[model samples]
Structures are given as C-alpha cells and as structure tokens.
Target: MPSQTKRKKPYSHFRLRKFLFFTVPFTILALFLLRTSSSSSSTASVSSSYTTYQPPWFGDLQTAQFPWNRLAFSLTNPPPKTLKLAVFSRKWPTGPNPGGMERHAFTLYTALARRGHRVHVFTSSLDPFLKTDKIINLKIHPHGDAESGKWRYNKAWELYQEENQKQPFDVIHSESVALPYWKAREVPNLAVTWHGIALESLHSSIYQDLIRKPGEPRLQSFNASLYSAVLPKILDEIRFFNNYAHHIAISDSCGEMLRDVYQIPEKRVHVIFNGVDENGFTSDKKLRSLFRSKLGIQENSSAIVLGAAGRLVKDKGHPLLFEAFEKLIETHSNVHLVVAGSGPWEQRYKKLGDQVTVLGSLNPNELKGFYNGIDIFVNPTLRPQGLDLTLMEAMLSGKPVMASRYPSIKRSVVVNDEFGFMFAPNVEALTTVMEVAVAEGAERLAERGRKCKEYAAEMFTASKMALAYEKLFLCIKDERFCIYP
Candidate 1:
C-alpha cells in the first residue's frame, strides 16, 4: 500500500505540472487579446468623430475679405517701409530636398533679401547657409536637430520671443504642417503655410504605408509599419487648426481644405502657388540623347519613354505606377519607364522586370538632363498632396505631364488638359492614360509640352510666388500697405 501511494503521488504531481504550463500561457494570451481589443475600440471612437463636420460653421470661407489679385504684381516691390521679417522653417534650401516647402522658403527669403528687407530665417540646420552672420542681410539660424521637431519648435518659440523684444517683427510665418498651436498671445501677427492638412492625411494613412501627415502620432502599436486609426495627433489637430486666424495655403485646394475642413475664414487663408528653379530644369538636346542611351533605349526604335521623380512612398503610388506599367506594356511594346528618386519602395520596384531605369535621386545638374530624356512625366500620387515640385520641374523642361486628379494639383498646376493629363487614383485610370500617352502622335505631344512650358514660366515662377506672399504680408501688417499693386 505504501509503494502504490508513492507511485500515485508521482503521477499526480506530473499531471499538475502539465496543467500549470498550459494554464499560465493561456491566461497571459487571454489578457493580451483583451487589452488589444479594448484599445482598438477606444481608438475607433476618436477616428470616427473626425469623419464628418458641420458646413459654414466649420470655416467654409467661400468669400475672402482680402482678395489680392496675382496678375497685379510681377515683383515684390517695397511700399515705403522695408519691414523686418522673421521666418520659421523646420528645413532649409541647402538640404537634399531642393523642392517642396523648403524650396519655396528659400526662393521667398532670397527674393525678399534681394529687395533689401532685413530677413532672418530660424530653421533646423547644422550647416547653415549665408557667408556672414550679419543681421541686415539674409541669414539662417541653426537651432536644434529636426529629429526632435517638438524640441525645435519650443526652442524656435523661445528664440522668436527673445528676438522680438530686441526688435519688433512685422510678420512671423511658420510652416503650417506643424504650427505650434496658438502662442497667439506671444505673437502680434502669425501666418502658417499649409503643405498638407492633418485630417486628409489621417484618412489616407489607414491604408497607405508610412504616410502620416503632420508629425507621427503617439502610436498604440510597437511596429511603425502598423498604425492605429485612432490618431492622437489628428485628434489634437481637430482643435489645433482653429488656433490661428491667418493661414497661408500653398494652393487653392489647400486654401479650400483650410476653409472647409478646419473652417478658417477665406479672408484669413491666403492662396500662393509654389515655384520651380526655371534655369535649373531646362531641356538639353545633347543630354537627352545621352540619358536615353544610358537607359538602353535604341536610337531607331519608336520607344515612348515615361518618367517619374520624387520620394517613392505609398502615397506617391509606386505600386500603382509599376502595376499599371506592367498592364500598359502588354500591347505597347514600344514603351519604357524611367524613375528618378529612391525610397522604401525601391526593393519592390526592382522586381517589376521591364525596361525600367531607376535613376536614384538626381543632382541639380542631372535633373535637366533627366527631364530632357523622358517623353512624358507622370505623377501617380494617391493623396491630395498640395503639389509636387517634380511635376513643375517636368513642365518647365517642356515635357508633357500625366498626374493624379487631386484637387490641389488640378487647381494649382493642371490648369488645363492641354498641358497634361489627369487620371483618377487607380491602376485602371493610370493604365488608360499611359496607353493614350503612348498612342498620341509626337507632334501633338510636343505641342502640349510647349504649352505647359510657356504656362509654367508665366504662372509658377519663384518671383511671382514671392510677390504674392509679400503682398499678403503687407496687407496683414498695415491697412495702407494693403493697396493693390
């Protein structure tokens, strides 16, 4: 009986150990699942609140009180007072990105400086531009690293406050993408330029990868690849946008977004088109042939080359472009694709297995030659990103364009179909456009390209954009200076 009892005790102990092992794991997994489910539900509630808004009461500024015409001024002519300006940008012109908001800032600041204004730029740059650290001329101040953008903003505010005490500033302009909410009491006049709005970005990021609008939100997940729909940053923007009375919209579509989405009054939102480096992007016949040869295009073959350049992100529609090219090539064997610029999507693009040339990001000198080689330039973006400098670069180079029908792109640059083509954001829409672009006669395409070049030169120059901004600054600063040029 003692031997049997010992054997039974050993068997019972073994069974107890097995049960505990499974029970402990099961309990942990159940807790984890519960926490995740609860978090998801709470996040969904925040995201859903932003899907709609009341009209008019929500800042639908259809009629602008300050209607300054663009056609009136070709240059930013000073009106008696050569005002002191304080500009804040997270980026500068010297960086790898010679386009976008930074490029606009550089052009405007340079133009303002050339006109003899005491322009000081507060930005995040290690190797700040300008030879001398003079207060009279155009000067760039290097603050904190851009990685800690919030820190930079805080420091920028502190710097602006300190500077204002020494000498009063006429206007303070901030990059609207990440404007510090209010600080209105500290600033007498503040204007923020919008590149892309928050809500629109949040809507796209649900499916689009690495496409957060403002700064990245405090994420619920450990992986940056997977983001929760309940964006903490976006929820904050729902309130933050209303803090400013004056806003600078980079395009008409941008202005409309501010007025309708954020409910900023039309009078408060100033629409200004971005400019391209005209001299930097002119087409060269010799360089065109050289670039074509480099891409392995046969001299005799009637190959219709299609080109695209920019950050190859999800919102840029790289997958759609590659996939559409595959479909478009089934019958049109005389077609080829050449893309300049590299990003996360390069690995995927490498697998397309076609006559595609990936010219990683080009230098300023290389850009002119690159545009010269391509027959058509395409912008297959999914998001309504204000406007791409690449598209303007392409147009200015006398190359025809094919772009997504985003309102901002359409209103700002796609003035008419004569200059370029606009397709809905889908593989099918793109496939159709590419097929037609390939099928179009050379003479007709050249005619369209010529029109694009002429129009872009007239409407989208740095001088013109700067002039419009200068007028807005004057209008806001003094009532008498608001007189139309």
Candidate 2:
C-alpha cells in the first residue's frame, strides 16, 4: 500500500506543475488583453480628424492605402496646366511624428497638389496603421523595408526610371541634396533644396566651443579624427548640392553658405522662405481661455505665458533657456513657461517647478490651441540651420517671438521692438529679453502680437509659398522663372 501511494504522489506533483504553468500564462494574456481594450476604447473619444489628417490626394480608397482618412482644406483652385511632379522625400507625412524635412515636403506638396499638379511622393517611411502601398491621383511609394539605404536608393532610382518610361516627370525636386536619380545628373530638369550643410552647421558655438560641457555638439566628439573621416563625405555632399541646375535655399543664410562655402554658382542658388498654414493656425479668444482654464489659470489672470517647442536638445539651447527662465521666475511671479515636445534632455530640466507646464507632443489642432494660449513664443536654438517653422506658426497665431539671433532668422524675420524680439542664445541675453517683455507691459505686448499676425499673414501663408513655387517651376520649364531685374 505504501509503494502504490508513492507512485500516485509523483503523478500528482507532475500534474500540479503543468496546471500552474498554463494558468500563469493564461492570466498574463487576459490582463494584457484587458489593458489593450481599455486603452483603445479611451482613445476612441477624440474626433477622427484629430487622429488622422488625410491629404486631398488620398481621395480614392481603391488605388490608395491611406493610413487614415484625414483632411485639411485651403482656398485655392487647381492650376490650368497638368504638370507631372515627382517629389523625393524619404518620409511620407502620414502621422504627427514628422521631422522638419517631412513637414517641408508635406506642406509644399499639399499646396502644389491643390494647384492641379499630378504629384507622386516617393518615400522610405511606412504607415504604422496600413502596411501597404498607397496611390490615388497622387501616389505615395513606400520603400522603407529595403535591406539598406544603398539598396533603397538603387531601387528607387530604377523604379523612377520605369515610372518615367510610362509617364515622364516634368520636374525632379528632392529634399536637401538627396537626389537618387536613375540617370544621376542626366535627370533632365533637376533641383534640390538645402536643409543644412554639414560643414557650415559646425560654425555654431555649440559645435565650435572648446571646453566640453554636459550638453555639447556630437560633431566635436571625434574632434580631428571625426572631421578627417567625414571630410570627404561632406565634400561629396557639396558635389551633390552643386549637381542640380537650380538650388533652392530655404533661407538667405543657407544661400550665402551655398555660394561661399560650397562655391555654388550664384546663377543656381535661389532663396525662398518657409510658409505656414494660416487657416490651420489661428488665435481665438475662446480657445485661449479654454486652454488657460485647463492649465488652472483664472479667466481674469494676465500671467505672461512663454512657450517653446522643439525636440529638447543642447543645440536647441534649452539648458540656457531653462536657466534664464529660472532666473526670470524668481523675480516675477506672474511669468510662466510652457514647453511643447519632448526628448532626452526632458528629465534633466524638470526642476523648473509649478510655473512650468510640459505638454509633451501635440497634434496640429492641439498645437494651434497651445500657440493661441501663450503670450510670447520663444525659440532659443543656438544652431538654427534652417528657418524654424515654429516662428511662422506662432506669428500666425498672433504671438510675438523672442528667438535666437541666428543669421537666417535675422534675414528672414522682421524682428523689431514692435514686431518681435531677438536675443543672443545664452542665459544672460534671454533673461534680458524676458525683463524687457515684462517692462513693456500687457498692452504693448498685445499690439506687438497683432503686428506679428499681420506680418505672417502677408509673407508666410502656404498659398503664397505655393504660388511662388508654381511660378518658379514655370520659370525653370521655360527659363522665364526669375523675377529679379
């Protein structure tokens, strides 16, 4: 009887272990499913428009695999002529997580499409929601899953050649110097925009400063070794920049660099400033009050809200701004700070206390609300290679800017005591700018904001930018593009 009991015990133990293993995994799976359900249901409340902004080109669902059905409209009619345009940007403007280059491509192409251009955007970015290619009147090609950049480049070049065989493109415009043409320089009428030149960007103090600090440029890390290694690459990039018959500089400073640093012929370089969507960006008294109320501010309160947005990094001069904001808040209790966007440096500067509100990342509509809620928009970027589009967005929202005194911004923005303020990118200079804003009082600030809106309306609307590009393309087509006398 004892021997029989022992055998039964071994079998019972094995059965218990099997039961426990299966139950534990099942429990975890149940919990995970429950959490996912809760999250999906919670996020379902926001409007479909807020979640996805589909461009007009993605109208036909059959040919196009739109990541989502989102729409934004502009008051413009299609052009008289149907020009086949091919835009080469690596990332498609599908979601909110767009980079500077992506935004430029998106805004420019959308404006162009509205003007009757047969546009096809070739990109190497995927839409997380929809895992397929998309094409309507305007085609979106995704080549992100390629083995390497070289492979993608080769494939894209060959594919474009094949595409052109069917229907030739009237224009070939690429982001910065990234022109991966099948025939290289033989791509008939080719043009490229300059986002930034690697050599010229090294001019910023963040890159040039000798003594190493906590937040400094990665370019200076390898020092001599790094520069020597990448010097040839930089020169090759310059060669590409010079390849295009026409070169578009997003700022005056960029144009100057092309002519001076790269020795690009003056005949090739053209400077065109960035533009903002006026209809999308606007300041409403009701929206301002609603946003302020969410921040726990009273309706009658006149606290001077200073807002800044960017991927928080050293080159952005956030450390300098944080230090200056700290000093300003100590003396003036009425001043507050609102930071938009997030990055590695966020935890480093969270000590700014209750006066600071970090909203993290925001969508286009939410961003408009944030712009309207703030009094002054500050961009303390130490190294602004291209024109910061935030400046245009803020001005569109009727907010005065207090930004770094970078060369491009200086040439681009109409910064005066009445329009806006500029400061050296440092603690002392920015602190002084805040002091001046405080001394100017509320009425003067309001008037300056009005001036900012007026200026932005005239010079920074997407419609104006599209019209410029339209004329530029026509000029390129017929050597009738240049308006300069």
**Candidate 2 C-alpha error for residue 249, in Å:** 0.5
Q: Tens digit of lDDT per residue, candidate 1, span 48-128?
A: 212222122212122332112234474534646677888888766665655577777887788777777778787764553
Candidate 2 deviant stretches above 4 angstroms: 1-80, 128-136, 144-151, 180-184, 205-222, 229-234, 480-485
Please write out the lDDT profile of model 2 over residues 43-153, one tens digit for every residue: 222112222342345222112111111112234545545678877776666666678888888788887876778787776746467443334457766565563222255
- The TM-score obtained by model 1 is 0.77
Any runs in candidate 1 off by more than 4 Å, and if so which? 1-69, 76-80, 125-136, 144-151, 177-179, 206-235, 298-301
How far out, in Å, is residue 454 in model 1?
2.0
Clashing pairs in 1: 58-263, 59-263
Model 2 lDDT at residue 153: 57
Best by TM-score: 2
